[model samples]
Target: MLIAQLSDPHLRPKGVLYHGIVDSNAMFAAAIEHLNGLSPQPDLVLVSGDIVDEGAPAEYEFARELLSAIRQPLLVIPGNHDEREAFRRSFADFDTTSRSGPLHFAAGDFGPVRILGVDVTVPGLHHGDFDDDAAAWLEQQLAAAPGRPTIVMMHQPPFACGIPYVDEYWCRNGERLAALIARFPNVERIACGHVHRFMQLRFGGTLLCTAPSTTTAIALRFQADAEPASYLEPPAFLLHHWKEDAGLVTHLVPIGRFPGPFDFA
Candidate 1:
């Protein structure tokens, strides 16, 4: 199974641009085009939160139209910037059951690989957490499908990225999450977003990967008063390919490289 991951589009309403520079709408469009052009074609497309800037009704409106064009099945969760109610209303086709709207989740089986979308967004807060229910649900899901290679997806990472500002807001219940995941030996990786940078770490014997935002990347600064959140890093995403024999392999594929020769020897 091949999963294409896109994160942090921060889509805005028509005529509205984020920080007077980044065009969220155009960024997402390019991302969709790139995904569609891939040769083998991913079996699934995962949007790792921050779908819109302020979760405006209009922003969701445009977002739905763009994501609808993707050829494969898609999965999503909410981010700090996303409003759960608005996100649900915009993408009613997805599976959302949590009352707080932050824990919209779904489970799917692709042969020997079991994929789970875990929601860790905390409304009205910059940081994220996994409550009792989310943790319980994960445990149940893992137990139900024992010995199957699993890929868990969420917005906030379970490990700090060493970037102070983001690290401060790292998932509060991350330790508990790690302990729970450790029980499931089948878990191959934990894919996440929210820091806006390509980050990775080892958590409880599983690979923890943070995908770069489709819009902009946060500058690597530890200062408290870092005026701006993100800088002009080329938009990129992650592609995780799963095989029964090999478990999982991933790539940090950058976007917006046009007219470059395909052979980069």
Candidate 2:
């Protein structure tokens, strides 16, 4: 099975640029085209979070139109920038899990993989949390399918990625999250967003991967006093290919029309 993960597009109204600089909507379109161009196309696509710049109805409306072009099955969770009710209404057709509550999180089987998306977005705040109720829910889901190769999807990464500014708003009570995931040996990885660049860390007895954005990357800074900023870097996404024998391997795929892929002479 193959899965493509695209994160943090931060879409605005049709003609508006993200943060009045990056053309995130157009880049997201390019990402859709890039996925279509893959040789062996992804069986599923996962949008980790932050579907729009601000939690606006118009943004979600435009987002719906844009996401309509994807060729594969898709699953999504809310990010700090996303509004839960609006997001729910936007994806109402695809997800009929409930009419109320936190972003309709649930587990579903897609061929060889069972994917469970956990919603931990903290309302009116940039940070998130793995509350006791959420932990209980996740534990129940993982326990039900112990042997299946599973992937846990969430917006905020459960571990610090060394970028002090971004780390300030990381998932709170992450230790509890790690402890829960450690008990589930079948978890292939913890797929996350929030951080705009590709970041990976060992956590919860498995690998944790944060997908790069379809727009700008949050500037990388190790200094504690560095101000938070973004860069118009090459937009990218992640591709996870899984096989019965090979386990799960993730590849970083850069978007846009780059230079030629010349063969070695």
Candidate 3:
């Protein structure tokens, strides 16, 4: 199965600009166009989080239109910048319910392969959480599909990735999240966004990756004297492919075409 992952689009309402520099809406449109041009096309398009800048009604409308251009099924969840009520209202098709604490969503099952979208956004807070209800929901899903190859998706990464500013607001209940994930041997990978950079790490015996932002990045300034990584960086996303025999492989697809390949070696 082929899955295209795009994160942190941070798209704003029309005529609005993010941070007075990055053109988030334009960048996201570019990303959508690029993804639609893929050769075999993807079975699904997954937006890990930050689908909008402020969860504004207008922003969702724009996001919906842009995402509609994709010819494949699209799966998404809320990010720190997203509003839970707004997201639920927008994506009404997903079986969303209050269910005590956090909201849960799941879709698509190709026999032994299933995709699960879990919401971890804590309203009004920058950090994330898996809470007890969410943990139970995830466990139940994995348990029910013991023989299936499961791919878990969320907004914040469960592990630290050296970006202190982002790390500070990462998933707080990761220990519980990791522990819950370890029980499911069928789980092949965990995908997340929010850190505005492409990173890979291991957690709960599975691969975890953070997709690059389709919009601008959160200036890489780790501290006062540390250099900076900012909007100057090009936009990028991820293409994840999974096969019955080979497991899974992910490619970080940048938006713009690069100059002739240069030898890194």
Candidate 4:
């Protein structure tokens, strides 16, 4: 199974740039085009979070218009920038249930891999939290599919990424969640977004990778007083391929055209 992960599009109302700098809409469109052109196209596309900038209805409508171009099955979770009501309204079809709550929590099988999409957004807060209910639900899902290769998708990473600015908003009760995950050996990878940069860390004997943003990137800084910053670095996404023998291998696919494939002579 092949899964393509894109994060932090942060789309705004048309004609507006996120932070008055990054042209999020254009970058997202390019990302869609890139995914559409992929050879052996991914079986699924997982959009980690931050689907819009202001979490407005109009913004979601605009995001919907752009995201409709993706040919593969797309799964989305909520980031701090996303409003559950607006996201639920715009992406009604993706929700696992029609009942009112945190948009949805979904789990399913795709070929040989099992996917679990969890919601960790805390309403209006910038930091993430996995509450008792969510943790228990995740534990049940993991227990149900013991020994199956599983991929966990969420918006906020459960570990610090060394950037003090982002680390301040790291998932609350992350250590507790890590303890739960530690019990599940079938959990192969935890895919996350929200940092707006590509980062990988080892946690609970598994890999936790934060995908890059489709709009802009967070400047890499480790100072305790570093202010939040963004740059127009090459927008990128991740591709996770699952093989029967090799488990999961990931590749970073960047946007825009670049020179390649000269004959090796």
Winner by lDDT? 2
The per-model lDDT (C-alpha) reads: 0.83, 0.90, 0.82, 0.87
- In model 2, where do residues sit more than 4 Å from their true spots? none
Error of 2 at 235 (Å): 0.6
**Residue pair clashes in candidate 3:** 220-229
Native-to-model Cα distance after best TM-score fit, residue 97 in candidate 4, in Å = 5.1
Model 2 lDDT-worst window of ten: 95-104
Candidate 2 lDDT by residue in tens digits, 1-265: 8999999999999999987888899999999999999989999899999999898999999998999999888899999999888888888887633477776365565679888898889888989899987898889989888999999999998778889999999999899999999999899989999999998889988999999999999999999898999888999999999999999999999998887888975
- TM-scores, one per candidate: 0.92, 0.97, 0.91, 0.96
- For residues 1-265, could you state the per-residue lDDT of candidate 4 as single tens digits? 8999999999999989888877899999999999998999999898999999889988998998998899987888889999888888788876453357765465574567778888888899889888887888889889988889989998999888889999988888888888998999888899999999999988887888999999888999999999988888999999999998999998899988888868885
lDDT of 1 by residue, 1-265 (tens): 8989999899888778887898878888998998899989998888889999897899898888888889987888888899988887677766644555455565664345667878777778878888887898889888988787888988888777767778877788888999998888899989999989998888977889999999888989867665546787889989998877777998998887668577777
lDDT of 4 at 35: 92
Model 4: CA > 4 A from native: 95-98
Off by over 4 Å in 1: 95-102, 109-111, 222-228, 258-264
lDDT score of residue 97 within candidate 4: 31
Q: Can you tell me which runs of candidate 3 are displaced by over 4 Å?
A: 94-101, 110-112, 221-229, 259-265
Write the residue-wise lDDT of candidate 3 on 1-265 in tens digits: 8889999998888878877777888888889888888888888888999999888999888888778887877778889999888877788765543434455676655334588888888999989888887888888888877878888999988787766666789988899988888888788889999988888888987888889899777676656455545665888899988888898889989897669767785
In terms of TM-score, the best-performing candidate is: 2
lDDT of 2: 0.90
Rank by TM-score, highest first: 2, 4, 1, 3
Clashes of 3: 1
